[model samples]
Target: MQKILVAGPTFPDVIERLKQYFEVDWNQGNALSGAELTQRLADKDGALTAGELINAAVLAAAPRLRVVSNMAVGFNNFDMGAFNAVNVLGTNTPDVLNESVADFGWALMMAAARRVVESEHWLRAGEWQKFQYDAFLGADIHGSTLGIVGMGRIGQALARRARGFNMRVVYHNRSRVAPQIEAELNAEYVSKEALLRIADHVVLVLPYTRENHHTIGAAELALMKSGATLTNIARGGIVDDAALAEALRAKRIGAAALDVFEGEPRVHPDLLAVPNVVLTPHIASATEATRRAMANLAADNLMAGLGEGPQAGHPPNPINPDVLGKARRS
Candidate 1:
């Protein structure tokens, strides 16, 4: 049988499914270092990974690696140029987790606007001796302008939710979404700077890319309303963590909530010291059902990319379909 590596912790059921077609090597513990990942892929025909870096060096070592299926919607960890050079198919699970992620983004925005985390921490620390009218004052979510940085699926979902709160929605995207979509969501297209200046709440849902790094930085923060809340459910590095930390420390913005960070699993020390910011380990698409769907979709991509499943040679979500026509190493 052709061999494959499940390069990160995943559902056991997903592993069982992969084992039906390939010799499966599964890693269920800590994330592997770059060298270890390269070493393991040395003999594999395909891989199913969650954020494992597959760069030029690793591809050079993995002579037989024909495909890599990433379990999340974002494949920023992938070195697409390397994959293309070697005709390695790359796929990601998308669409399945959109609603779940949108839900979390909305929650994060609300939590930040309402000072939910700050108040909870204060109560837990026995700092709430008496209720004061001015205590834990936070920005209002209702009847305010909501600015979304990316008007993609999750961003549209967020815009739809804004209607219930009677909010006016404005979004800045790489390009404008269709007019019907804008009408349906009651959203207005705006410049990033305009959105930052006028919004009472801002949520980021854009994908991460080299050009998109630090989409929100010191200057962007300075443009925001002093009473506005900022929330990020997008990939880390989309916001400059250091700059955000400084803004929060200076009360430049009302509060901030982050679900992703730069150099994550290791948050910035300044952010930790600030009491107004809310931080969560990246878990936006973490609902049980959504996660399972993502895992199964990834498995489908892996199987199809490896020519082992019903959709053999036609993975549903190929990041680089041109590779399908090229000679695969496997």
Candidate 2:
């Protein structure tokens, strides 16, 4: 049987499923370091990972590696260039977690706009004595303008949710989505600057790319309305956390919410100091059902890519499909 490494903690049931087809080396503990991962993968033929870095150096060490299936929609962890060069198939689980992540994005936006986390922390500390009508005043979601960066699956889901709130949706993406989709969501395509200027609440759903680094920086933040709220459900480094923290501290923008931060799980010290922001450890796709779906899909991708399952030789979500039939570099 082909040997595979499971590099992150996952549902044991998924492990059992994988075990039926491959010799599985599952790591149920903390994430393995690069050196440790290289060592463990040296003898493996394939691997299933959740946002673990899989690059050229690691590939060089794992001469047998032929496929890598990532559980999350984002394959930013995988070095696509290296995978393509080595003809190692790469796949990611997408679509399944879109709604769940969109739900979380909405939750984060509401939490920050309404000061949920800040007020909760105060209440927990026994600071609430009497209800002050003026205390924790926040922007209203209803009948407001909603700006979404990256109008992809999750972005559209968020826009659709805005209908009930009577929000006017405006989005800025690399390219405009289909006109039918825009009509369904009641969304309008707009320039990033226009979105910043008009939106009362802004949520980022863009993918991380070299060109997209710090997509929202000091300049973009400055462009937003003074009372506007900012929310990020996108990848870390997409926003300048330090700049955001400073803005929050100075009340340059109303409030902010972040689910992903640069160099996380080590957040910027300045962000932690600001009480106007809500922060969460990247759990946007964390609902039990959604996570299970992700795990199952990842398992399917791994098995199928390795030509061992119902969808043998046809993985549902191949990131680098060009490498599918190419001879392995090793």
* Clash count per candidate: 0, 0
lDDT to native, each model: 0.93, 0.94
Q: In model 1, which runs have C-alpha deviations exceeding 4 angstroms?
A: none
Residues 1-330, candidate 2, lDDT per residue (tens digit)? 999999989999999999999999999999899999999999998999998899999999999999999998988999999999899999999999999999999999999889999999999999999989899899899999999999999999999999999999999999999999988999999999999999999999999999999999999999999989999999999999989988888899999999999998999999989999999999999999999999999999999999898998999999989888777896
Error of 1 at 151 (Å): 0.7
TM-score of model 1 vs. true structure: 0.98
Top candidate by lDDT: 2
TM-score of each: 0.98, 0.99
Name every residue pair that clashes in candidate 2: none
